[model samples]
Target chain A: MSHIHIDIRKKTYPARDGSGEHLAIRDLHFELAAGEFVCLVGPSGCGKTTLLNLIAGLDRHFEGSIRADEGAATLRIAYMFQNPRLLPWRTVRENIQLALPKGEGREWVDHLLEVMGLTASQNQYPQRLSLGMSRRVALVRAFAIRPSLLLMDEPLVSVDAPTARRIRQLLVRVWQERPHSVLFVTHDLREAIALADRLIFLSAPPTALLHEVTVDIPRGEREDETAVEAFRRRLIGEHQQIRDLL
Target chain B: MRSLLYHPISSFLLFLAFWQGLAVILASPALPAPQAVFQVLYQEIRSGNLPFHLGVTLARLAVSFVLAMSLGTAIGIFLGRHEKLDRFFDHWLVIFLNVPALVTVILCYVWFGLGEIAAIAAVVVNKLPNVVVILREGARTLDRDLLEMAEAYRFGRLKTLLHVIWPQLFPFLIGAARTGIALIWKIILLVELLGRSNGMGYQLHLFFQMFDVAGILAYTIAFVAVIQSIEALVLKPLDVRAKRWRR
Candidate 1:
């Protein structure tokens, strides 16, 4: 059965200065098959975040319906914002644990900390962590619930390129253990290519669906230098705008 | 003890020396020497009057402080979260905030007729608006992103409030508490001064009428000492603990 289904007809927000309504996303429709990793790529200010928010049910004012194949009440959704959004007052472990349902044991949490290389920093507060470390913690928290649906909004946008690459690898490793339906939002074409099973492109503000690309390459081969180069060249050959972005 | 006393002792000695010099220069009964004031203080303590009045004043401070803080926080959060409620009562908050504390005390005394309830009610009324104002700002500036995160995760109401909301609002709570305690202490003293049978302010009022300068000085010094200790011991430790997360 399809795990997640989103069929948004229209989503418009009032202008900030009390002007008039601005169309954020309209006629947007998509679905995520179980265990599929779908990336939503678009230009900056393309309302990718808004679209993700609508799917996550964070913004209900928007027109259109988003339904989980499993009823909304039974479906568990985990969201990772562009910002780490850790509770500053809580320790790293506490922040992660807060995401878990009550009375759950420490084994999974300890395992996640070890896997994310966050064991030493578990007792430290969010402010004490570097950007890379904070993002890792946020990822752990998002996955802590072992959620059926995971929503990521450019979760690795800010770090230095090298750190971002490593974190992305760590992300793939974590998700591999339990493949869940993911709808990730990003503007980086390379990242969307590297991680997503399928990519959905949206046009700039007053966003509309533009294109969809599927990566048939096996998961393990995606990390190889040559494979990434081939995918990059193919995307460049096909999508001129995505090439300009890179 | 030695380390703690080193700085405070030097400061206290310097203050005493300055007071002694001023008393000598003025050479009036109104300005007693520190030695004379301490002598009166020692006598009052030995006779047990100082402790009794101080105890009464402290009890009032405790009751009023708790009442104002609890009620203020609830109302502040309610007003801040609900726009219509805020619009309805925001003007009332402004009026209450602007009203002179003395007027509140006088009115409380007149309305309730010089009882414990009146004195405590006056102090609570005086401090409540300020607490509400602070917590209201805290509620207003609440991190919407974090709230969305909590909502997405389906956090229970208790978990959301304790783990997400309270931690974010903690600094504001501390701000309100610190200011509330200081303000309530002063207002409680005034309430006692206007109409009360026993308390530091009542004793001070009696001494003022009789021109017993040393007695007044003794009471003032005792109250100041207690307040200073509370600031140093209670509030300072709390501030440090609450802000351990901050670098």
Candidate 2:
């Protein structure tokens, strides 16, 4: 089972005002085996989100090329945004069903909604949901797709601390159930620590890859102490070094 | 429940009292008392022509409103789906929104030669832009994550729209429809007055020409009552039902 190899080399977007080019990704390169979980952390305005968009083929205007070696576009890629971004009018279940492949969508929608603890609120709309609940709905919506690649962009930014922990657990469980490559982007160092198998630290503006640290902390362990201490000393050092650059 | 009904009426009665009090102080007949207006309204009802005129006006308003709503919604959905198209037609919406309804009605009359189509067209032209703007804004704010999820799952375009986009846009569309109906009715009446021979606006003009203050007040009261009934019986219930998803 070969994995997706996204060779992103020298991507840039000309600044909107045309004064200068906003170099979003400069000479970026990365490869993930089929089931590896990757987390990308960066400073504010470091353009990790933009890079995610480019990789997803949502944005085609860039200086460089992205060659996807393994999965076809039909292999499917689920993306979760900073905000849950649930459709306000659709019931949470309907929102998930809307993401499923026609006839096969309903059962998965039901199952995933249950998995996300949204079965009770299945009939409720996005506006009626709390922040954590909304993000969970977003999670179920993304996870239900059975994507070859799961791309997450700071999806839990607004949830409470305790809720965030629970969500992190759910994410890991889903990852275990269907071992897909996940490109998780976050600003939270603790979050990048808790979830990622491979952590990539992105540099400040005119974003470029800085450090690639492989966290060997065993999964299914206590997320707080187990994940943190395993790579804490080295990860913290790299985190602070990148922090000073911004 | 009783207080809710009484509050607005009492407020209106108080306003009328102030106007009547000023009328008494100035000793003028130009501004009639509320009772006088009510009396005039009663007299118009007794005259037996009120119902026929009211019926005609209501019919005109219905046709105009429906035309404006469906067309505006269709155009809005298209504009919302296509950003390039939205930009191209955005200036047209600005022009329509700013143009006075009366001036637009006049132009319709000039172009269409005083037929019922002119009246209907005038109301539609005035009402369409408002609905379009509301729907376009709704379309722009649609959640992209949900859409990306839909794409990833490989839902057909029909399923995505039916289950995803339509459900999301329904509340916005319904609210726009409700408010647009309220606006379209008044504009339609104006169009009826300037161009069409029958309808509330035309009847109001007729009463004015004949110095029949009671008749004018009767029609005004009738239209106001109809609007309130529509709000209470139709739009309010629809809104409650639609917003249940949000709840």
Candidate 3:
């Protein structure tokens, strides 16, 4: 498990053609304790992905100090991109194997295949699998590393509702088994509420943290449809701005 | 096996019939009957001269092809990944690509003297540019998403290249290899003809001086048959193995 501390004084992207600049983030700050599940919710095009990129160390143009406390081993961060970036040339099992730490065995990959409901499709190439199946493989690949921090960038955005729900449940199941610090970005408030222990909401572009909502509902009570509906309703009623963004 | 034999055998017979018809029509030494050329082919094979010359040509082709392809792919990948380097070296690729094979052979012969090194060097220089151009496009178009995935997962450099980068680059490498062999073998003949006293091209040159059209045709047919066998046996099988992942 890893605790991530993010402090951004300001971050501005220069204009490509020498016009004005784009203020992607300004004075935004947040932190995550070890094994905490946090969901970042924001309006569309509000630099949610940019924030994840900064935390994941993919984008360094930002003026920020993002630190992850090193545990026994150096921190291993696995990112599940918005797209299911499985290599088309590799099989599902091989794709997961690509993310295994050095000297890690194939038994973990077999277990991941079982967990992802991909036993039959383990030998299949990415081109032949459905998008949901591909996403599951990507998730399996991410978790196979037994990461200290996992950054998910709208992983279920383009899937249908049923598949998205199933994948979300699969994600929760895997996380519960081996808890890791997770920062999931999503524009869907319902998804954010359903998945995260704590929800941090952000405003439009030049994003600054608006609010942090802790889910009081227990883990066992979370899967009930009526309970989720009640919690979502209460959340929207309490945060009118979140309802407005929705 | 029957299906495979049917088309090629039928095509071979059809070609022979056309050749026989032309021989009968022309009734000239320039155009010998297919059977007459085959007779010379059989005699040369039995005498071992044809096989020896063919083996020499094959050896030269192998060395030059290996040199050209390895150098070309390395340079192409280097240029493709580095945009500034690509810009600096783009004009050089153009120059080498446009230079004629015959001219290159003659220049090598003039500069390095009439030797095996000159002949092989000419063949390599002529073929290298084409491989470079093809692989440059391959390297340029490598998927950024997959690369980011590799980095995020902390894949080591060798693993990333083998499991991620090499698979993406395989099709381009295959393309370069196929065309390199086709173009380089023909150029090797010119190199051998101009400089070397051995190989199929040199033998063909000797037959030309004697005005022996049947001997020339026999050598040509033998060389072509060897190339076709390599394509069918080696290249096609390798292509299928590399691309088996594709649906």
> Which runs of model 2 end up more than 4 angstroms from their true locations?
A63-71, A102-115, A126-130, A158-161, A187-190, A210-213, A220-227, A234-246, B1-6, B9-49, B71-102, B128-183, B245-247
Please write out the lDDT profile of model 2 over residues A1-246, one tens digit for every residue: 346766566677778999887667777778777788899988878988888887777777775565445436445678898887666767788677666655666776777777888889998878888899998998998888787788899988878899999898998888898788899999887788788888888888667778888877667564756558656666666576755643
Q: What docking class should model 2 receive? A: acceptable
Question: Please, what are the lDDT tens digits per residue for candidate 2 over residues B1-247?
Answer: 8796579788887888897898678765555666788887777678866778778877887888788878888888889889999999889889989999999999999998898888788888998898888888888887777676565455668877886687678788888878887888788777877777777888888988988665677689888898889888988898888777555
Tens-place lDDT per residue, model 3, A1-246, is 567788997889987888989888999999898888899999889999888888777777878788877642477788999999998888888888878866585777788789889999999999999999999999998888888888999999989999999999999999999999899999887788788999999989789998899987788877787887898899889888888877
Off by over 4 Å in 1: A17-19, A239-246, B1-8
After TM-score superposition, the amount by which residue A145's alpha carbon in candidate 2 deviates from its true location, in angstroms, is: 1.5
> What local lDDT does model 2 show for residue A23?
68
Q: Per-residue lDDT of A10-36 in model 1, one digit per residue for the tens?
A: 888888999999888888888888888
Candidates ranked by TM-score:
3, 1, 2
Candidate 3 lDDT for residue A160: 99
lDDT for each candidate structure: 0.88, 0.79, 0.89
Give lDDT for model 2: 0.79
Q: 2 or 3, which is superior by DockQ?
A: 3
